[model samples]
Target: MKFDKSELQIFANYCVAAAESMAYTLVRTAHSTFVKETEDFSCALASVDGLTFASPRTFGATWYVGLDYGPVIRSLTDYQPGDVCMTNDPYSGFVATHTPDVVMWKPVFYEGEIICFVAGHIHNTDMGGAVPASLSRTLTEIHQEGIRFPPTRIVDKGELNETLLSWMMCNVRAPEQNIGDMKAQIACLTTGERRVLEIVERFGVDAFKAGIGQLLDYSESQSRAVAKTIPDGRYFFAEYVDEDAVGGKPMRIALTLTVDDGLLQFDFSGSDPQLTSSLNVPTGGHPRHALLLVGLNYVLYSLNPEIFLNAGMLRIATCEMPVGSVLNPVEPAAVGMRSLTCVVVQAAVFGAFAQALPDRMPACPASSVCLLNVKTTDTSGRTIMASIGPVGGGAGGSSAGDGSDASGANMAFLRNTPVEINEAEVPIRIQEYGLVADSGGAGQYRGGLAIVMEFKVFAPNTLVTARNRDRTLFGSWGIKGGRAGRTSLFVRNPRTADQDILGNTDLVACQPGDVIRLEGNGGGGYGAPFRRTVEAVERDVRRGYVSRQEARERYGVVYEDGRVNAAATAALRADMAEGPVEANAFFDYGPNRSAHEAVWTRERYVALCQCLETVSVGWRFFLKHQMFDRLAERIAEGEPIDGVQIVFDLFAELKAQFPALAAQQARIKQVA
Candidate 1:
């Protein structure tokens, strides 16, 4: 049953149609906002070996197109025809990136033979935890996060595991909604099984099996072809999460991508160790998790959008993550807030590729999704908790054009809940929802505008949780001389004289008439603002994206009478273009990263990484923490000091503080 080119393509399209049909069923039937509206659920058909063969293009999460089903499928002893195994624990199996995402898998059987597996996972709103949404950036361990279902049968051989399902639902705040969404996933998986069976019956089992295998191979070939276009070399970049939520220190995600002859090796061995916060990502050490979707999305998407996004692309690369690192944390480590970290992961990806594909990749984006939770008891005495709406993360500006505003450049699958839906489901009133003016970073191609939302709590004693909120301390970096995007903030009672500027918080209790304002960060800009055409500058000024004065100051384009002042614009450009340039003309890391790099110079940063390489991975995080603590202490003293000298001194202090572990880390100090 060897497939020729034409036959293989036709067969591939058929499988894709089946996958889309499955996802359509779920999207149509789901009750949770995360699934029905946000479209965070995904349905796929997998080969017997557990690699995804067909993924829906028109629906569900496109970022998880490369997820593997083999590990979890193999964890069980055996599965009957209608048996469905479910898991959300990242460490227990390769089922999900976090606990809130419940994954279910079923085997498709035809003619008394197993043909393929049908799998689907959706972001369940609540799963029983310390918080209503089961996601907390401050929560230190998974034990406090939620109920973890680790590869257990929720439906046994066509019979509903009612006892197990009901018991599980009783644990979450949104029991009815959670159960309904869980059933939606099961229904979609069952639909996938039915669709695959129909395809097998029509084409015959042998041809169907061959086609599924061929699909992955075809996708791999296309991915490899794209990989070849990237010059073979090592590209290095690092980015930080704004803060640990509980602590003020930033977290690092360092990556050195080695591209060689159409093969990509992502070396994250230099990343920081696991943290005591939910920000840790429980990736199960899988290279193709949602966080790593940056490389897959940027490269394959830019090159060929029609290629099958299956496990085939996974064959072209390997990821090297050190054990116990934040990306691959150990058991009991909180993983509720993985998406915020995903933002930094993309920064490292863009920063690295900016080195290799300067003209291709845009600057860093203020691209982290946020959740706003409201918890309170209804009049009937039943507790209610739900996410009010999805946070809008503006996309980074690109050479092709300005990034999409508010909707997001990444995680495009998660749609914002409608105002009507939020009002009806939760006890709150939406006061305002719109794009922030002058928030987008300025460049030849400007970044997208930030979204601002205000909500008034009408219910008494309402506890609100807005975890993983960031970018207030640091702005999104721009590239090619573009200025950084503006930062975000949490304002309380903005219209009143008692308006308080609240930065970021995990949770805050509120009463009736209390207002909360969330301003999402803008995406990074691309190219220099001054290099932008005067016409574009005038257009931005008119559109409220840039003010007339900002246009004159930032882009050197003086605007008057609703248009660019030609003579003044010419004079200003002449003055600016010839003036002394402070940074490189190629990349703009924004002021914060640039200032930090001045002291933590790339040379020093890399040297620090090398020095820690001598110590055990477990102790590296504490040592790094000590270094940052001492550096901050010195900086806070208001004494002008060199950052590089501070790092050297910090190492000496560490050596003296931990003499027993000096043998592990002092070698680095001695070498430096």
Candidate 2:
């Protein structure tokens, strides 16, 4: 190590301060409500090799601490002193996870030598696409998502490329907002460059370079030290997204976390193939990609809060994603809703780690965040596109205490926009916005309650896209003997004669006076509900977080006249304790999942995967959907399902249905 402990600490603080300053500049000067208020952006200082060493710790999204800019950096040619490169293409280097997340980076030079790079990304509200927000689960391909920008120099030698800038703005709905946000990003990078130069001037170029390397090494050591705390073993867990596409069946994401000594490997081999929706995650096969390790980052921070936030933390971990899988989809595959898929990945990682450390881990959080966007017209009839803030649900309960209410948990970095801001910006009326009672799962450490948001739009033909609306069919799973959380609900014209229930539907068309109500899923509980004290249940009822009926039924605690009946509660708990126990009491995946799994057993899924592997990437989702439909029909008729034989039969039928696949039927049959 070139620098001593004290010297390295000072250098690290300086770098962090620089990154934080960049974030401050961006948040204060940004135009969009998503950026200035919701805070869905990040800033970091990376090494010359594009390894993030320092990022804003207390501001913006925490999902990019280990974001690698190396791919985007190497994609471009020789960099001038003031060259600022940009890219939003998911297939190009995987730096920008989706089209809406516009990423930009500027090189910092000292004495004709590159010292470091300043980089960050902001979530644009609109980027011309099929939907208003450029994101929807219904979108089938990347072309439908939005226009993409590959790695190129948006700012060449400190001068803005007017042609490139104009070309980008001409394609989006809100050109003014997008241009303002882009300029704010450039300003942020400029702030970072100045700060980096200051550090080099204060510490000398030699010490600054040496100290940066030592800081990464120190962070790597901290991560390894935390890994040593957990027992070395393989922990496997699987989670599901409510829908594969619009009105589609549930999709599975399997993870096997292998912890050997101080090293960790996330294997996504048994996961489902790429979907025909925008929920795919474009990782580009990078082992330490930010999307794959987003969940791991939260886990490491929860285990040891002192661990440094940088690419070094991911040094102890690597990822194995099957090619053509949801996590590593091929080019042209839609990835607008990758954030939603990443949440499921987080839940799977959390589930896997719970087995390794049951006492310390928390139950599943509300694995969904509904990002609502409104496209309406004013009185003059001009098109107006606005984002109505992200309404996320509660976090799961842990040993420490109850989970947080209305928080995104792992994605808590996405700050919510105030109702005042939303109403003031867009022509909409905010009706009801509060917590839902009895939605949280009951346990010793009770889960957090869900959120309810209802709003009315006055304009007719108002288009609303609620991307990432999930948990409508299956709720968040609980751990130990705790109960599962409640499922989400989305409705139009609620409590009216023309009310309509929409389940996991992302796009909606509304008429005047139509009220849209969206209720997010609650967080799962930890430990046993019977173990929760009577006082906790009574307090929850008094606070309106839990209903009196829920207290009596779920928690086995009786409440009379706004007070707990001690004698009755004790008797009810005793009676509940004597009831039949679940076979695998570790996880409580609600009745919906339990029933679905009963029909589609693990053996059936294994057989289905075997059949899928025999088909091409383009035909996998098509064949999977056909098999699912056939299985549902057979189950409804009470007919026995031969899982293995059914897969082969479906393949043969599909081959005959499509003449293009007819020639490959023989090869498929031979492989099967």
TM-score of each: 0.94, 0.97
lDDT of each: 0.79, 0.88
Give the best candidate by lDDT.
Answer: 2
Work out candidate 1's RMSD over C-alphas.
Answer: 2.9
| Span of 10 residues, lowest total lDDT, candidate 2 | 660-669
| Tens-digit per-residue lDDT, 1-672, candidate 2 | 388878787889999999999999999999999899989999999998999999998789989999999999888878899888899999999999899999999989898988889999999999888888999998999999888999999999988999998988889998999999999999999999999999988989998888877888988999899888888999988889988998898899889899999899999987889999999999988998998898889999998898778999999999999789899999889999999999999999999999998998999998788988999998889888878888778889888888899887877468888899989888999999999887787888888888888999999999998989899988888898888888899999998888999988888999898999999889999988988887887788889998888888989988777667889999999998998999999999999989888876766777777777766788888888998897787778998767567667766777678887765755766877
RMSD (Cα, Å) for all candidates, in order, is 2.9, 1.8
- For model 2 the TM-score comes to 0.97
Q: How accurate is candidate 2 locally (lDDT)?
A: 0.88
Once fitted onto the true fold, the runs of candidate 1 whose alpha carbons sit more than 4 angstroms away are 287-290, 378-382, 561-563, 610-620, 636-648, 658-672
Residue pairs in collision within model 1: none
